[model samples]
Target: MFLEVKNIVKSFHNEAVVRDLNFSLDAHKTLSILGKSGCGKTTMLKIVAGLENADAGTISLGGKNIDNVKPGKRNVVYLYQEDLLFPHLNIFENIAFGLRIKKFPEKEIVEKVNAMVESLELNGQETKMPHQLSGGQRQRVSFGRAIITSPSLLLLDEPFGSLDAGTRQRMQEFFKSLTAKYQITSLFVTHDLKEAILMGDEIAFMQSGRLKVYKDKTDFINDPVTGVQNEIGFWENLIPGKVERETLRK
Candidate 1:
């Protein structure tokens, strides 16, 4: 296994957020954490990313206990719903920030940044500032910055949630291709179940700080008590063939 989150419990002001959770992931596999608003999904991701610690639990990456580790050395990169790129830095500089911080050679940093730009289709946008780019472009930069670090794991918190339907679908395809190409292990958090099915290899459903997994898409759709299936099924079931090609396009 590449990551293990064991019996995690987090609370604030005596209000439980993440209730006793246990899950693990394999190397190079993508996992999505799905739930409604304020289900402690984001908190769980933060715990694994080392940005927040669990009140009672353990997070191990590559067999190392990282509960007390600092966020920078945790070998995980996080991309938030909004573009969290450095506002003052240009695209090239923002993506190269990690390499520069690690003191990589100038030539290597250039090469790495260029490769990432090409991969992310940010070729000519390298010199643009954060305010100059569109929402989609800025999100791309956020993803590029995280990937450039070569982190052992990546966490995306509703990365495409801010984009419109069309742009969001486009990014979904691009991100899916990128992750599959790099074989990156990630724990993605989102409220969109359709996004989870299309972007993640597997998904864990969370309800009020609790997490559960289904055997497959079919099982997920048929869950009686929770109705935890992907939104596509829910939509299709409600309106047969109403799901047109355009509705699900990238």
Candidate 2:
């Protein structure tokens, strides 16, 4: 296991938000966690990123216990739905921010930032500011910025929630390719069931502060609590026999 979270618990105003959470993720794989609003998804990611304190539990990353590590020192990056790029910086500078913070040599920073910009498909737009880019493009820059530093873990909280349907789908595909290219180990939190299924190498569902990690996609789809069946039923009802026909064709 590259990242291990054990017996994690959290509360606010004496109301438990996360209960005895336990999970392990392998390096270079993405685990997509599906949960509705206020299901402790963001809280869990914050805890793992060291942004929030866990009342009890242990977090280990890359074989080292990080329970007491500071957010900056944890070598973990937390990305939110908003592409929180620096408005003052151009695309190139935004992606280069992390490297600059670490004070990498000037030549290396240029090489790395340029390469990242190219990978993000923003080569000629390096001088453009965040406001000048489309939603998907800005999000790509955001991803490039975070990934350039090569963090040990990346926590994504509904990263495409703000995009339009078309842009969101494009971003999903882009994210898959980006993560693979970087060999990123990420915990992707989303309420969107289809997105969850498409993004994860392994899948888990969170509800009422507890989590259930499925053994595989088949198990996840079969679990009634996850609402996959309900979704299937809705479509089946909408166009009678459509699902069965598609399944049979396959």
Best by lDDT: 2
Quantify all predictions' global Cα lDDT against the true fold: 0.85, 0.94
The per-candidate count of clashes, in order, stands at 0, 0
CA lDDT of 6 in candidate 1? 93
- Once fitted onto the true fold, the runs of candidate 1 whose alpha carbons sit more than 4 angstroms away are 225-250
Give the best candidate by TM-score: 2
Off by over 4 Å in 2: 244-250
| CA displacement after TM-score superposition, residue 194 of candidate 2 (Å) | 0.2
Clashing residue pairs, backbone N/CA/C < 3 A, model 2: none
Worst 10 residues of 1 by lDDT: 224-233
lDDT value, residue 27 of candidate 1? 90
Q: Candidate 1 has what TM-score?
A: 0.91
